[model samples]
Target: MRNLLILLVFFATSFGFSQELNCNVVVNAQLTGNENLQIYKTLEKQLTEFVNKTQWTKRKFKPQERIDCNIVINVTGQSGENFEASVQVQSSRPVFGSTYTTPVYNVNDKDFSFNYLEFQNLTYNENQYESNLISVLAFHINMVLGLDAESFSKEGGDPYFKQAQRIVNYSQQENFKGWKLEDGLQSKFALIDNILSPTFSDFRTVMYNYHRKGMDIMSTNDKDAKNEIALSLAYFRKMNANRPNSYLTRVFFDAKAEEIEQIFSSGPSVDVTTLIDLLNRVAPTHASKWRNIKF
Candidate 1:
């Protein structure tokens, strides 16, 4: 009750305009073994500022409300201004009452090839493609914001997702790997496209139910919360029956497998037998983590 009042008061009083994302951006060029680490450091600093400083949404957000996320650009090779890189994006949100924050979006996009010069200004234009660096970063940030919002309210992420889809649309025209349908099954195009497609609607439902219904209630009624979480996994079973191990499904389990194991392992006793079986079927890749579950 105290936390709720504090939050309500915060929202009511926080009329100040603030950045939407509290994100950490890292540029890891160690693999390249490049002597000129200055460029990579500069890239990291610029990206961190660009993402954290950009006002993603029109609504005002207090400091605590900023979405927590991270971006890591692994630079594998570089030649002149061109470079080969892979990007891993992760974002999470706080539970309603507890100090625990659940992972919401976790994805690593390979083939993030882009060109950059030292000290180049990074800017984002919603309607235009200035560069892959800007487009990819902005797209992920918006998607993170969208996912965070969806966890709180049903269909709350539509606008941000549409904006991300637009980013993909603009980026498809550019020379990039993760922005097109042909990039691979796990491409950024496939990620957002599958999410928005009615064929995979249950994915979004699981997002809402797993977070809002399940995790939020855990501190109050852990037993019921466990049941709610297990029920939420039923959406995955239905999605698997249709697509059978989809990219989006893999994406969910990628972020959630560890958390799922932890939740069901040492919490109030609940029948997760069906859940374990369903998980193995839908996300076989995480069989190892599922096996670690004692309960």
Candidate 2:
């Protein structure tokens, strides 16, 4: 990731675009058994350039401030230019005053099916409906930005999320599976809709408290930082009371379960008894990991 910083510096100095994402893209076609491997390589390269080179935000970010993320697309089938796939997108940010980089967003979109030709241009205009491929890439990039921002400040993610919502709105005209209400609970539509809805607003605060107020301060006082982190989980408890086993809660735990376990397991022994109970109640799906909290 450090090497990407040098490349980004060159980009900001050379091109006028203030690109904000340092994305590592992977296109896997092992399941397709398509002998024409060159096309997949081409697709990977083009998508890599599109994601890293395209400026997703208006705010200029220093090279080190660029968000670190990964996009993995597994190609299941290929019919000429049309491909059926699933994509996993995740992003992380460095903790202030620490070497740790914590996972912020980890989501898998299973309904990714797109048409692409090697060397074809992929472009995104928020107000327009382009290819599903472009829309999906743009959506995740904005989502990464939104989640990253939410970590820095309370609801700072709202602007980027609105951009993602716009992408969802226009992409709906194209009838993408992940952009509509009826696309199941795990759809991208439900994810962003829940975040923006005032009903689930506590989740955003949990982001700021958990990362900015908690992890960022860990180096100063592990006990106090852990306490702040445990207090943030109370927000999840309230959220679970209103909406049990929510898609948003599930998403949060997906990226956070392992880290939570590690944090409580090794840190200056804080009373995690209540925190453990809270985890079991709120993210019971991770009960196994919760059970592993030794301290």
Q: Which candidate is the best by TM-score?
A: 2
C-alpha RMSD of candidate 1 = 5.9
- Count of steric clashes across candidates, in order: 0, 0
What tens-digit string does per-residue lDDT give for candidate 1 at 1-295?
9999999889765555478888888899989998367999888988888888877788888778988998999999999999889999999999988999999999898868899998998888888999988888888888898888889888888999999999999988877788988888888898889889898987778889999899999999989888888998988877888887789898889899999999999967888889999989998999998998778
Model 2 earns a TM-score of 0.94
For model 2, the stretches where C-alpha displacement exceeds 4 angstroms are: 1-15
Q: For model 1, name the residue pairs that clash.
A: none
Candidate RMSDs in order: 5.9, 4.7
User: In candidate 1, residue 162 scores what lDDT?
Assistant: 95
TM, every model: 0.93, 0.94
Best by lDDT: 2
Q: List model 2 lDDT by residue over 20-134, tens digit each.
A: 9889999999898873699999999999999998878788888899999999999999988889999999999999998999999999999799999989988878778889999
Each prediction's whole-model lDDT (CA) = 0.88, 0.90
